[model samples]
Target: MSEEILINSTPNETRVAMVENGMLQEVLIERNRKSSIVGNIYIGRVEKILPGLQAAFVNIGQSRAAFMHVTDVCSQEKLIRLEGQQAATQSDVSLPPISKMIHEGQRIIVQVYKDAIGSKGARVTCKLSIPSRFLVLLPDEPNVQTLSIR
Candidate 1:
Protein backbone atom coordinates (compact mmCIF):
# COMPACT_ATOMS: atom_id res chain seq x y z
CA MET A 1 0.00 0.00 0.00
CA SER A 2 1.16 3.52 -0.85
CA GLU A 3 0.01 6.82 0.62
CA GLU A 4 0.68 10.35 -0.58
CA ILE A 5 -0.42 13.92 -0.05
CA LEU A 6 -0.90 16.48 -2.81
CA ILE A 7 -1.20 20.17 -2.07
CA ASN A 8 -2.14 22.99 -4.42
CA SER A 9 -2.01 26.66 -3.53
CA THR A 10 -3.36 29.71 -5.28
CA PRO A 11 -3.57 33.38 -4.31
CA ASN A 12 -7.10 33.05 -2.89
CA GLU A 13 -7.36 29.38 -2.01
CA THR A 14 -5.39 26.29 -1.05
CA ARG A 15 -6.34 22.63 -1.49
CA VAL A 16 -5.00 19.42 -0.01
CA ALA A 17 -5.63 15.93 -1.34
CA MET A 18 -4.83 12.64 0.28
CA VAL A 19 -4.19 9.59 -1.89
CA GLU A 20 -3.83 5.93 -1.11
CA ASN A 21 -2.79 3.35 -3.68
CA GLY A 22 -3.38 5.75 -6.57
CA MET A 23 -6.91 6.54 -5.41
CA LEU A 24 -8.04 9.83 -3.95
CA GLN A 25 -9.23 9.45 -0.36
CA GLU A 26 -10.07 12.97 0.76
CA VAL A 27 -9.80 16.57 -0.33
CA LEU A 28 -9.68 19.66 1.94
CA ILE A 29 -9.86 23.15 0.59
CA GLU A 30 -9.27 26.45 2.37
CA ARG A 31 -10.02 29.88 0.99
CA ASN A 32 -8.67 33.27 2.03
CA ARG A 33 -12.10 34.90 2.09
CA LYS A 34 -13.81 32.24 4.21
CA SER A 35 -11.55 30.20 6.47
CA SER A 36 -12.67 27.23 8.56
CA ILE A 37 -12.67 27.16 12.40
CA VAL A 38 -13.17 23.45 13.03
CA GLY A 39 -9.97 23.04 15.04
CA ASN A 40 -9.32 26.58 16.21
CA ILE A 41 -9.09 27.36 19.93
CA TYR A 42 -10.42 30.45 21.64
CA ILE A 43 -10.79 31.98 25.08
CA GLY A 44 -14.55 32.43 25.33
CA ARG A 45 -16.61 34.21 27.97
CA VAL A 46 -19.70 32.51 29.35
CA GLU A 47 -22.69 34.47 28.18
CA LYS A 48 -25.70 32.47 29.33
CA ILE A 49 -26.50 29.17 30.96
CA LEU A 50 -29.70 27.31 30.13
CA PRO A 51 -30.51 24.82 32.85
CA GLY A 52 -33.45 23.47 30.87
CA LEU A 53 -31.20 22.40 27.98
CA GLN A 54 -28.16 21.70 30.14
CA ALA A 55 -26.03 23.85 27.85
CA ALA A 56 -24.33 27.23 27.78
CA PHE A 57 -23.80 29.94 25.19
CA VAL A 58 -20.30 31.39 25.08
CA ASN A 59 -19.03 34.47 23.34
CA ILE A 60 -15.79 33.91 21.43
CA GLY A 61 -15.79 37.30 19.66
CA GLN A 62 -17.75 35.95 16.70
CA SER A 63 -21.01 37.33 15.34
CA ARG A 64 -22.96 34.82 17.42
CA ALA A 65 -22.24 32.94 20.61
CA ALA A 66 -21.09 29.31 20.52
CA PHE A 67 -23.04 26.50 22.19
CA MET A 68 -21.45 24.05 24.60
CA HIS A 69 -23.28 21.17 26.24
CA VAL A 70 -22.72 19.87 29.73
CA THR A 71 -21.14 16.75 28.27
CA ASP A 72 -18.51 18.90 26.57
CA VAL A 73 -17.96 20.99 29.70
CA CYS A 74 -16.80 18.09 31.88
CA SER A 75 -13.08 17.60 32.47
CA GLN A 76 -10.93 14.77 31.10
CA GLU A 77 -10.50 13.37 34.61
CA LYS A 78 -14.24 12.80 35.05
CA LEU A 79 -14.49 11.12 31.67
CA ILE A 80 -11.66 8.76 32.47
CA ARG A 81 -13.23 7.87 35.78
CA LEU A 82 -16.56 7.21 34.12
CA GLU A 83 -14.91 4.95 31.56
CA GLY A 84 -13.58 2.72 34.31
CA GLN A 85 -17.07 2.14 35.75
CA GLN A 86 -19.51 -0.44 34.45
CA ALA A 87 -22.20 0.49 31.93
CA ALA A 88 -25.00 0.10 34.44
CA THR A 89 -23.18 2.26 36.98
CA GLN A 90 -22.46 5.04 34.48
CA SER A 91 -25.88 6.65 34.87
CA ASP A 92 -25.43 6.86 38.62
CA VAL A 93 -22.28 8.93 38.19
CA SER A 94 -23.89 11.65 36.15
CA LEU A 95 -22.19 15.00 35.70
CA PRO A 96 -23.16 18.08 37.66
CA PRO A 97 -25.49 20.68 36.20
CA ILE A 98 -24.07 23.16 33.74
CA SER A 99 -25.04 26.12 35.91
CA LYS A 100 -23.13 24.63 38.85
CA MET A 101 -20.03 24.07 36.71
CA ILE A 102 -19.96 27.52 35.11
CA HIS A 103 -21.58 30.89 35.64
CA GLU A 104 -22.10 34.00 33.57
CA GLY A 105 -19.10 36.31 32.98
CA GLN A 106 -16.53 33.58 33.46
CA ARG A 107 -13.72 32.99 30.93
CA ILE A 108 -13.03 29.55 29.52
CA ILE A 109 -10.89 28.09 26.79
CA VAL A 110 -12.60 25.96 24.16
CA GLN A 111 -11.92 24.38 20.81
CA VAL A 112 -14.29 24.41 17.88
CA TYR A 113 -15.68 20.97 17.16
CA LYS A 114 -18.48 21.88 14.75
CA ASP A 115 -18.97 24.85 12.47
CA ALA A 116 -21.93 27.16 12.47
CA ILE A 117 -24.94 26.43 10.26
CA GLY A 118 -27.68 28.89 9.33
CA SER A 119 -28.51 31.08 12.36
CA LYS A 120 -26.70 28.88 14.86
CA GLY A 121 -23.16 29.52 16.07
CA ALA A 122 -20.28 27.04 16.22
CA ARG A 123 -20.18 24.20 18.75
CA VAL A 124 -17.21 24.03 21.12
CA THR A 125 -15.68 21.63 23.61
CA CYS A 126 -13.42 21.97 26.64
CA LYS A 127 -11.66 18.68 25.98
CA LEU A 128 -9.19 20.08 23.50
CA SER A 129 -6.64 18.06 21.55
CA ILE A 130 -4.04 19.84 19.45
CA PRO A 131 -2.89 18.05 16.32
CA SER A 132 0.54 18.42 14.73
CA ARG A 133 2.53 16.71 12.00
CA PHE A 134 3.77 13.94 14.28
CA LEU A 135 1.25 13.64 17.14
CA VAL A 136 -1.91 14.91 18.79
CA LEU A 137 -1.19 16.49 22.17
CA LEU A 138 -3.80 16.09 24.90
CA PRO A 139 -3.12 18.75 27.53
CA ASP A 140 -3.43 17.83 31.22
CA GLU A 141 -4.12 14.24 30.22
CA PRO A 142 -2.54 11.04 31.48
CA ASN A 143 0.79 10.22 29.88
CA VAL A 144 -0.23 7.29 27.73
CA GLN A 145 -0.28 6.78 23.96
CA THR A 146 -3.67 5.33 23.02
CA LEU A 147 -3.08 5.15 19.28
CA SER A 148 -0.71 2.96 17.27
CA ILE A 149 1.37 4.61 14.53
CA ARG A 150 1.06 3.13 11.09
Candidate 2:
Protein backbone atom coordinates (compact mmCIF):
# COMPACT_ATOMS: atom_id res chain seq x y z
CA MET A 1 0.00 0.00 0.00
CA SER A 2 1.18 3.50 -0.72
CA GLU A 3 0.89 5.22 2.60
CA GLU A 4 0.47 8.97 2.90
CA ILE A 5 1.74 10.84 5.91
CA LEU A 6 0.18 14.27 6.36
CA ILE A 7 1.99 16.97 8.31
CA ASN A 8 -0.11 19.78 9.59
CA SER A 9 0.68 22.59 12.04
CA THR A 10 -1.96 25.25 11.91
CA PRO A 11 -5.61 25.54 10.78
CA ASN A 12 -4.64 28.18 8.23
CA GLU A 13 -2.31 26.03 6.13
CA THR A 14 -1.83 22.35 5.23
CA ARG A 15 0.61 20.65 2.93
CA VAL A 16 0.45 17.22 1.29
CA ALA A 17 3.54 15.84 -0.34
CA MET A 18 3.39 12.47 -2.09
CA VAL A 19 6.53 10.40 -1.66
CA GLU A 20 7.42 7.71 -4.12
CA ASN A 21 10.68 5.77 -4.09
CA GLY A 22 11.75 8.01 -1.18
CA MET A 23 11.44 11.02 -3.48
CA LEU A 24 8.71 13.62 -3.47
CA GLN A 25 6.76 13.51 -6.72
CA GLU A 26 3.86 15.81 -5.91
CA VAL A 27 3.25 18.53 -3.39
CA LEU A 28 -0.12 20.10 -2.63
CA ILE A 29 -0.62 23.09 -0.43
CA GLU A 30 -4.09 23.91 0.87
CA ARG A 31 -4.93 27.13 2.61
CA ASN A 32 -7.93 27.49 4.88
CA ARG A 33 -9.49 29.82 2.33
CA LYS A 34 -9.37 27.61 -0.77
CA SER A 35 -10.05 23.89 -1.03
CA SER A 36 -11.46 21.46 -3.53
CA ILE A 37 -14.66 19.62 -2.68
CA VAL A 38 -13.95 16.51 -4.71
CA GLY A 39 -14.20 13.24 -2.77
CA ASN A 40 -16.10 14.92 0.03
CA ILE A 41 -18.98 12.93 1.47
CA TYR A 42 -22.12 14.91 2.03
CA ILE A 43 -25.47 14.19 3.59
CA GLY A 44 -27.19 16.18 0.87
CA ARG A 45 -30.81 16.86 0.33
CA VAL A 46 -32.15 16.18 -3.15
CA GLU A 47 -33.31 19.47 -4.63
CA LYS A 48 -34.86 18.45 -7.92
CA ILE A 49 -35.43 15.35 -9.97
CA LEU A 50 -35.39 15.41 -13.76
CA PRO A 51 -36.79 12.25 -15.26
CA GLY A 52 -36.00 13.37 -18.78
CA LEU A 53 -32.30 13.56 -18.00
CA GLN A 54 -32.32 10.68 -15.52
CA ALA A 55 -30.45 12.88 -13.08
CA ALA A 56 -31.00 14.88 -9.92
CA PHE A 57 -29.66 18.15 -8.60
CA VAL A 58 -28.46 17.82 -5.03
CA ASN A 59 -27.58 20.40 -2.43
CA ILE A 60 -24.27 19.45 -0.87
CA GLY A 61 -24.01 22.79 0.96
CA GLN A 62 -22.08 24.26 -1.96
CA SER A 63 -22.56 27.44 -3.96
CA ARG A 64 -23.98 25.54 -6.93
CA ALA A 65 -25.96 22.29 -6.97
CA ALA A 66 -24.33 18.95 -7.64
CA PHE A 67 -25.42 16.47 -10.30
CA MET A 68 -26.22 12.83 -9.56
CA HIS A 69 -26.99 10.32 -12.26
CA VAL A 70 -29.27 7.32 -11.83
CA THR A 71 -26.62 4.81 -12.88
CA ASP A 72 -24.24 6.13 -10.24
CA VAL A 73 -26.83 5.72 -7.50
CA CYS A 74 -27.15 1.92 -7.56
CA SER A 75 -24.83 -0.24 -5.49
CA GLN A 76 -22.80 -3.08 -7.00
CA GLU A 77 -25.06 -5.56 -5.25
CA LYS A 78 -28.03 -3.86 -6.78
CA LEU A 79 -26.43 -4.20 -10.19
CA ILE A 80 -25.82 -7.89 -9.61
CA ARG A 81 -29.34 -8.38 -8.36
CA LEU A 82 -30.65 -6.64 -11.44
CA GLU A 83 -28.39 -8.61 -13.75
CA GLY A 84 -29.52 -11.87 -12.17
CA GLN A 85 -33.13 -10.91 -12.83
CA GLN A 86 -32.37 -10.53 -16.51
CA ALA A 87 -31.02 -13.20 -18.80
CA ALA A 88 -28.47 -10.74 -20.20
CA THR A 89 -24.88 -11.19 -19.15
CA GLN A 90 -22.81 -8.43 -17.60
CA SER A 91 -21.05 -7.65 -20.85
CA ASP A 92 -24.29 -7.38 -22.77
CA VAL A 93 -26.47 -5.40 -20.40
CA SER A 94 -27.02 -1.83 -19.29
CA LEU A 95 -28.62 -0.67 -16.07
CA PRO A 96 -32.20 0.44 -15.66
CA PRO A 97 -33.43 4.01 -15.31
CA ILE A 98 -32.34 6.11 -12.31
CA SER A 99 -35.79 7.53 -11.76
CA LYS A 100 -36.99 4.13 -10.62
CA MET A 101 -34.22 3.98 -8.04
CA ILE A 102 -34.12 7.43 -6.42
CA HIS A 103 -36.75 10.01 -5.60
CA GLU A 104 -36.76 13.72 -4.72
CA GLY A 105 -36.37 15.10 -1.16
CA GLN A 106 -34.36 12.01 -0.19
CA ARG A 107 -31.35 12.61 2.05
CA ILE A 108 -28.63 10.44 0.59
CA ILE A 109 -24.96 10.10 1.32
CA VAL A 110 -23.12 11.11 -1.81
CA GLN A 111 -19.48 11.62 -2.67
CA VAL A 112 -18.16 14.22 -5.06
CA TYR A 113 -16.98 12.26 -8.08
CA LYS A 114 -15.92 15.24 -10.14
CA ASP A 115 -14.98 18.83 -9.45
CA ALA A 116 -17.03 21.72 -10.62
CA ILE A 117 -15.80 22.83 -14.01
CA GLY A 118 -16.81 26.28 -15.29
CA SER A 119 -20.59 26.56 -15.09
CA LYS A 120 -21.07 22.85 -14.48
CA GLY A 121 -21.74 21.51 -11.02
CA ALA A 122 -19.80 18.81 -9.24
CA ARG A 123 -20.70 15.27 -10.21
CA VAL A 124 -21.83 13.19 -7.25
CA THR A 125 -22.30 9.49 -6.75
CA CYS A 126 -23.91 7.30 -4.14
CA LYS A 127 -21.40 4.59 -5.02
CA LEU A 128 -18.22 5.55 -3.29
CA SER A 129 -14.84 4.63 -4.78
CA ILE A 130 -11.81 4.56 -2.56
CA PRO A 131 -8.39 4.47 -4.19
CA SER A 132 -5.11 3.35 -2.69
CA ARG A 133 -1.71 2.89 -4.23
CA PHE A 134 -2.29 -0.67 -5.42
CA LEU A 135 -6.03 -0.94 -5.68
CA VAL A 136 -9.23 0.92 -6.34
CA LEU A 137 -11.72 -0.06 -3.69
CA LEU A 138 -15.32 -0.52 -4.61
CA PRO A 139 -17.38 -0.80 -1.47
CA ASP A 140 -20.23 -2.83 -2.96
CA GLU A 141 -18.14 -5.26 -4.98
CA PRO A 142 -18.09 -8.77 -3.49
CA ASN A 143 -15.04 -10.03 -5.37
CA VAL A 144 -11.78 -8.32 -6.16
CA GLN A 145 -10.76 -8.84 -9.74
CA THR A 146 -7.27 -8.12 -10.93
CA LEU A 147 -6.45 -6.92 -14.41
CA SER A 148 -3.16 -7.20 -16.15
CA ILE A 149 -2.12 -4.04 -17.90
CA ARG A 150 -0.33 -4.51 -21.14
Query: In candidate 1, what are the lDDT values of residues 1-150, reduced to their tens digit?
Result: 999999999999999999999988778888898667899999999999999999999999999999999989976466557557544454566677899889999999999999888899999998889976557998856676766545
Q: Relative to the true structure, how large is the alpha-carbon lDDT of every model? A: 0.87, 0.79
In model 1, where do residues sit more than 4 Å from their true spots?
A: 1-6, 10-13, 16-33, 79-92
- The reply for model 2, stretches above 4 Å from the true place, is 1-34, 75-77, 86-88, 133-135, 146-150
Error of 1 at 20 (Å): 15
Tell me the TM-score of model 2. Answer: 0.68
- Across 8-48, the per-residue lDDT of candidate 2 in tens digits comes to 65788888877766766566787887567888889999998
Q: What value does the lDDT take at residue 142 in candidate 1?
A: 66
Where does candidate 2 clash, by residue pair? none
Best by lDDT: 1
Tell me each candidate's TM-score. 0.73, 0.68
Task: Score residue 64 of candidate 2 by CA lDDT.
Answer: 89
